[model samples]
Target: MRRLLAICVGIFTATVAWAGMPNVTFPSIDGGTLDMADWSGRPVLVVNTASRCAFTDQYEALQDLYDTYRDAGLVVLAVPSNDFRQELGSAEEVREFCEMTYGIDMPMTDITAVTGAKAHPLYRHVKSETGFVPRWNFNKILFAPDGSVVDTWGSKTTPMSRPLRDAIEAALSGD
Candidate 1:
């Protein structure tokens, strides 16, 4: 009886398999959390976005990328930000614009800062570990299933670019 109880306790106490990354949660645009841990064991393409920038059109390709890879366990997360003074005035305007103009259905966060002292923990951690930060709106960060930074790119790197796609593919395949 003692051995059986110990075995059960050990099994219950075992850590999660996807324990590589720290817990990071974003305020969801849909009025809840967009927790990174929830998508553990999946690759996440996170883009710091804005509604009024020239690169705003990249939102379309982002949606397309998500549509293409979602079924394969890829998660595309849009993080709308006003750090560059280009995002819409509020989350409402941002959501309305993204849905009306781009028909985006991917997960999105409420307006959040992506750089500097007030930058979200996601950016801060990325910078500290990988020395990468959003140079401008639409910057992308690819996180592997283990929560490690797989790759990063600036505003000019479109979501559907070959290199970005390759990185996503590699991450998705656990390579």
Candidate 2:
């Protein structure tokens, strides 16, 4: 009985330790690496983006959100992905287009897979935690300061939508 109890305790401890965000890293579009762990203490808005998708215009709103809330501890991370086959062929092209078109200066990851067997580690971790995956470009996943998923929105949800903004505000204010 004591051995069984000990085993159960160990399992509980291990599960608790793994409850939060996955420790994953991705190559930044500009340079160097992006370690999700680095943003541990700040609320992060992670969006899977595609340069050519119809919803790509949301980049403007994303930048606006970043500009509006970054001062309040919101880290907006734009992760360019080709899972939907709408992203540009190269990171440089993506950078040029985003910069010239929307003047986007937020942090972005290189072309990544947001779904399927080749999904990025961060996406996989998100799926494990929330059982949600990007159905298309512009899907948003909001993470709390502690690295847990606070909320998720589908591709049709605009970055500036009231629900998304409210959630970001709540996460920032610790509501």
Candidate 3:
């Protein structure tokens, strides 16, 4: 009985540890898959974006953040979401708008649902792990190198905001 109990506990712990970002992936907007495994040793900033939202301009800040920290092993993943009904109609439209309007070049996922039962698996995992659902477009979730939630920010928290930048710096430094 003791041995069986120990095995069960070990399995439970492993499951819990693997339940976060590392276990999820999404369809990359460019092509193929965007596996979390590809970003295994880096901190990732996962942002839910909307091309037509008031906060859409945040894309430029996000790009700046990506350009500044990507060399330090940061992955800024843009997930275009329409859960708030503020996104373009299709992934193509989103891609064009982001490129043409903001000159964004970071990795982006196809239009995805960031809330409700139809939310993508990654967002679902994020909600399960941190109880954070994107309350509005441009909400950000930062993950540590070990695939754990580091911090989350609402729409108003721009990418270069003090809190968000501090968290990214800390995560990159493995703090």
Candidate 4:
């Protein structure tokens, strides 16, 4: 009986786990709603960023990638998560810093937890599916056009790395 119960629980857990990606609704930093569904059929590059983190310079590279790929079905969304330490200012402040410091014109979303007990819903999927996190800062998650996680890159991986750019190109091709 004990073995049977354990097997049943395992099967049930697997069923729930494989159901589908959870729908996530987050407020854009610009005070707008951004539903994950809207990004369907478009490859997405999600990054956890901070205004004061040492890796902040990646913003410029990220913006460059976005500018290059925006016409190719690539959407780079920066999510300012302060889960590590309070390294970012208000949403408005982040916007100003990104715009002035790096000239970042890509889409940016509200600051939220990317790890720990309070990790946001999208991050929960990112961490579980990709087995990675912001770790420090500037960790990236690349999702296919079908909303499936394709790959993850750490802070050490520059945004313009050949592998990343190629992945984005492949995802754009959706092939």
- Leading candidate by lDDT: 1
TM-score of each: 0.90, 0.87, 0.87, 0.84
Q: Candidate 2 overall Cα lDDT vs. reference?
A: 0.88
lDDT for model 1 comes to 0.90
User: When superposed on Cα atoms, how far off is each prediction in RMSD?
Assistant: 2.9, 5.3, 4.5, 7.3
Off by over 4 Å in 4: 1-19
lDDT of 4: 0.82
Ten-residue region with minimum lDDT total, candidate 1: 12-21
User: How high a TM-score does candidate 4 get?
Assistant: 0.84
Off by over 4 Å in 2: 1-22
Across residues 66-94, which tens digit of lDDT does each residue of candidate 2 receive? 99999999989999998888999999999
Candidate 3 lDDT at 57 equals: 89
Clashes of 2: 0
lDDT of 1 by residue, 1-175 (tens): 9999999876644423222435588999989888787787899999999998999999999999999999999999999999999988889989999999999999999999999999988889889988998989999999998778898999999999999999999999988
Instruction: Give Cα-based local distance difference scores for all models.
Output: 0.90, 0.88, 0.87, 0.82
Residue-wise lDDT of candidate 3 within 1-175, one digit each (tens)?
A: 9999999988755544433533477888887787776687689999999988888989999999999999999999999988888888988899999999989999999888889999998778888877898889999999888788898999999999989999999999988
lDDT-superior candidate, 2 or 4: 2
CA lDDT of 47 in candidate 1? 96
Best by TM-score: 1
